[model samples]
Target: MVARYVVSPRGGRRAYPSIASALRAAAARGRPALIEIAAGRYEESLVAQGDVRLVAADGPGSVVVNQLRGTVLQTYGSVQVDGLVLTNRDTEYDVVSCWQGSLTLDNVEVRTPGGVGTHARPNTRATLRNSVFLHGRTLFTASAGTIERCRFTDAADNAVAIIEGAQVSVRGSRIEGSRIHGVRVCDARAEVVGCELTGTGNAALMADTRAELAVADCVITAVHAEGIMFIEQSRGSVDRARVTDARHGVGAASGADPVVRDSVFTACRDTGINVQTDARGRFEDCRVVGARNIGVFSTKGGAPEVHGCHISGGNVGVAITEGARGRFTRIRIEDLTTTALRIFDPDSTGVFEDVRVDRCPAGLEVRGNGGTTAEVTRAEFHDFDQAAVALAGQCRVTLTGVTADRGMLGLGIGEEAQLRAFDCRVTRVSSGGAVVFGSARLIAKNLTVSGSEALGICGRNSALLDITHGEFTDCALVGAAFDDECTGRLVDCSVGGTGDMAVRHNGLVDLASLTTSLPVVRNREPVPLPPTIINVINIINQKIITGPTIHGDAINNNFAWGNDHVIQNQPTEEGPRT
Candidate 1:
C-alpha cells in the first residue's frame, strides 16, 4: 500500500537527516516498510513499531549514525539494518536493542567514542552477520538466533554471550581483547565454529549452566586463563581446534563431560586436559605437549577415554587417580621429571593398550586403597632410573607383550599385588633384573631376561610365583631366586649363565621338561604332575592304539599362569603336589 510519511523531530521545516524522516514515514504507515538512509550524519534516537528494514545508501563507514546521548535504535519486531557505521554511541546502555524482535545486520558497526568499554548490550536478539561490534561490553546476545562472520574487539565483558534458551551459531568470527571471556554460552545450545579468540581474562570459550556447546576448527591463543572451561553439567565437544599459550588448555569440571578430539594443546601452564567432579568424556587423537602441571588429569570420579594421543613434557604425563578411570590406547608419552603415569589413591581404572613411555622418572606407578586393573599390551619402556613398571597396594595388573630395557629394575611387584606378565621382555639392566618383589602372587610366561646384575627373578615377601617358557641369558647371578616364602613352578624354561649359576630357584616344580643341563629346582622339592603324567601315559597308550597325541597338554606341557587363573599343581595321588 502506498505508505504514508511522518518525519521525526516532526516539523514542517524538513529539518532532520533523511534517515529520521524515513523512519517517521515508515511508522506513520504502520506496516512493514523500508527506510532508505542516505549517506549522511543522522543524530537521533530510533524506535521501531513493527517489522522494519533500515537500508543504507553506502557501506559500513559511509552511512553514519552519530549519537551522542545514548541509544540509536530500539525495536520491537523483526528488523534488518545493513551497511551502516554507527559511531559515538552510548557507553552506558546499548546502542541498538531488539528486545522482542530479531535483527539482521550486515557490514554494520557500533563503536563508542570512548575506549573499548562502550555499550551494555551492543546488539541483542540479533543476527550480526559480517558486522564489527567494536568497543562494547558485548557484541551481541543471540537469545535464539545466529551470528556469523562477526568481529568483537576490546570488550569489557564477554564479547558474545548467548543465553536464555537460545541456540546460537557463531561461525568465522574473531573475539579478542576481552576483559573477561571471549565468548560465553550458558543455559543454551551454542556451536562456535572457525573462530579465533585471544587475550581473554577468563576462558576463551566457557560453557556453563547445563548447555551443550560444540567448538570446531577454532584457534585460541594467549589466553590469560583457561582456553576452554566447561562447568555445571554442560556437555561440550571441542574438535579440530588448537589451544596454545594458555593457563589451562581445557578444563571440564562440576559434573560436566567435555570431549576434546583431534585438537592440539601446547605450552599450557596447567594441565592440558583436566576433568574433575565425575566428568565422563572422551579425548581421541589429541596432542598435548609442554604442559607445566599434567598432560591429562582425571580427578574426582571422571572416566575419560584417551586414545591415539601423544602427551609429553609435563610433571606427570597422565595422572588418573582419586576415582578417575581412563581408557587409553596408542598413547606415546615420555621425558618427565615425576611419574609418567600415576594411578594412586582410591583405585583408578586405566586400560592401556599399546602405550609406550621412553625415559620417564617413574613408569606406570599405581597404589592406594582400591586396586587398579590394566590390560597392558605391546607396551615398551627404555632408559629409566627406577623400575619400569611398579604396582603396589593390593592392585591386580596384567602385562602382555611388554618390553622393559636398561632400567634399575624391570618390574617391582609391591606387597599385596597380584600381577601377571605374559610374553614380556626385561633386558640390559644393572641392578635388579626381571623383578624385585613384595607381591602376593605373580604369574609370568615367555619372560626373556638378558644381562642383569642381581637375581633375574626375585619375589621377596610374596607368596606364589609361576614362571614358564622363560629364557634368562648371560647373567652372572642366580637366574631364579624366590625369597621370603616365595614359591614357584618352572617348566619348559632355560636359565643360562656365563659363569656358574643357572636356575638357582627356591621353589617347587611339577612335570617340567626342563631342557637346561642343570636341574630346574635347587632348594625346593620337585614332583611329577598327575595330570601331566596321566596325559603322557594316555598319549603313549594312544600311540600304541592308533597314532601320536597331537596338540595335547602333556606334549607341550601347558604351564601358563595369569592373574585371573589360579596356579595349582597337577592332581596326583600325593594329594595335590606343589
Candidate 2:
C-alpha cells in the first residue's frame, strides 16, 4: 500500500506532524510515495534515501528550502524534486548536492553562500532543467550530468566541471560573473549550445587533457582572457558564435585539433585566434576585429586552414611565424595601424600562398631569416601609409594582379630578398614606383605606375633587374631605372608617360616592345554601393566565389565588389583598326 503525506501550514492538517515522520511512514509502506510541501520557508535538508517524489503546492521560488548544512539532498535511489526554491542560508557548503543516484530536478534554484567550495566534489550528478544556480564557487563538479534551460551567475570558480569520462550537456543557459572558466571539461565530453557566457577567465569554455567540447550558437562577452581554450590535445569545435572583449578569443594549445567556423570576435585584447604548440586547426568564414595583437597567430609548426575571413581593426591582422605553413584564401584586412599580415620564419623555409589584403597600413609585412616563399595575387590595397608589400631578410615574394592606391612606397625589398611584382597597378603614389631597395634579384612585368614622385623601379644594391612586358600609364617621375651597382635587363616593356627627369640615375632605360591592347573591362561583381561601407564580404564569400572565374558574365560568380571597382564592358572593334 502506498502512503501519501500532505503538509500545509494553512489547514487543520492531522496527516503528518513533521516531514521526517511522513517519510518514515511512507518508507515503511513498501510502495511509491508522494510528499506535498506547502508554501512556506522550509529551513531543512530533505534527504531522499529511496525512490520518492517531492512536490510543492506553490511553484518554484514559493516553497523555499534554505539549507545551511553540508549537502541539501543526498539521493541514494531515484528522487524527483520539482517546483521548489532551494536557497542557501549563507551555508558553509554547497546549496544542493546530489550523489551517484539519479536525480531529476525541474524549475529549481540552487544558490550558494558566495564562497569557494572547500571539498573536491562540491556537487555531483545534479541534472537540472529550467533552474538557476546563482552565486557559488565550484557549483557543479559532476561525474555525469545534463543541465538545460538554466542560468548561472556570480560563480568565481568553474561553474560546471566534468571529469572521469562524464558526459555533460548545457543548453539555453546564461553563465556569467565568473573569475575563472565558466565551464571546464577534464577527461569528459561536453556539449554546450544556445548559451551566453560573460566575464570569465582564461576561457569561457575550456577542454583539457583528452577532453572534448562542442559549442554552438553562443555569445561570449567581456572576458578578460581567452573566450575558448583547447589544451593538452583536446578536441573541440566552435561554430556560429560571437566572442567579444577578450584576449585571445579562440586558442588551441599543445597539439589540440579544433575546428572554428562562422564566428566573430570583436575587441579582443590579443590575437583573435591562436594555434600554438603543434596544434592543427581550421578557421572558415570568421571575422576578427579590434585586436591589440595579431588577428590570427599560428606558431610552433602548426598547420592551419584560413579561409574567407575579414580580419581588421588590429595591430597585426595575421602572423604566420615559427616555421608554420598554411593555405589562406580570400582574406581581407583593413584599417590596421601596423602590419596587416606578417609571415616570419626563422629558417625562411615556410610558404604562404594565395593571400589577399585591402585598405591596410601595410598590406604584407615579411621579416625572417628563412628563405620563405609567398604569393600575393588578385590583391587590392587602398589608403595605406607604407608599402603595400614589404619583403625583408632572405625570402621570396611574388605579387601578381595586385593593385595599390596612394601607397607610400609600392614595394619595399630589403637585402638578400628575391621579389617579383607582375601585372601590378599603382595609382596616385608619391614615392618611388613599384620597386625599391634590394640586393637580390628583382623582376617587374606588365607593371603600371601612375602619379608617383620617384623612379618607377629603384634598386640600391640589386643583383639583377628584369623589367619586361610592362606598361607605365602615368608617373610623376622616371619610368624604370637601375641605380649604381645594379644590373638591368629590359625586354618588351612599354614606357609611355613620364613624371619628370628627376634625379638622373646612371642606369639603363628599357623599352623592349611598346604594345597597346584595350583592357578587357567587365562587371566582375555586383555592387549597389553602400552609403557606409559594410564589411559583409567575408560572410558572403563563404557562400559565393567557390570556383574559378571563367568569363565576364560567369553565371554564378557572386562576387560583391564595391561600386568603384565595377567597370562595364567596352564596345568591341567591329570595323577596321581606328
lDDT of 2 at 196: 95
lDDT per residue as tens, model 1, 1-578: 53433233333444344566676667777888766555666677777667787767555666777778767777777778888777664566677766665677788887764333212132346677888887675433335667788888878778877765567788999999887898887887889999999999899999998988999999999999999989889998999999999998988888888888899999999889888888777899998999998998888888788889898887788888787788889999988776677776666777888888888856777665545666688888888766677766677788899988887667766557677889999888654455534445678889888887655765544457777898877665556555545566767777666623555444333326444433333433322222322322232233211235333334535322112122323322222223
Q: How far is candidate 1 from the true structure (C-alpha RMSD, Å)?
A: 12.5
lDDT of 1 at 320: 83
Model 2: per-residue lDDT, tens digit, 373-447? 677777777777666776666777888888877866677666666778888887776565555444666788877
lDDT of each: 0.71, 0.67
The clash count of every prediction, one per candidate, is 2, 5
Cα lDDT of candidate 1 equals: 0.71
Question: With candidate 2 superimposed using the best TM-score fit, by how many Å does residue 411's alpha carbon deviate from the native?
Answer: 1.0
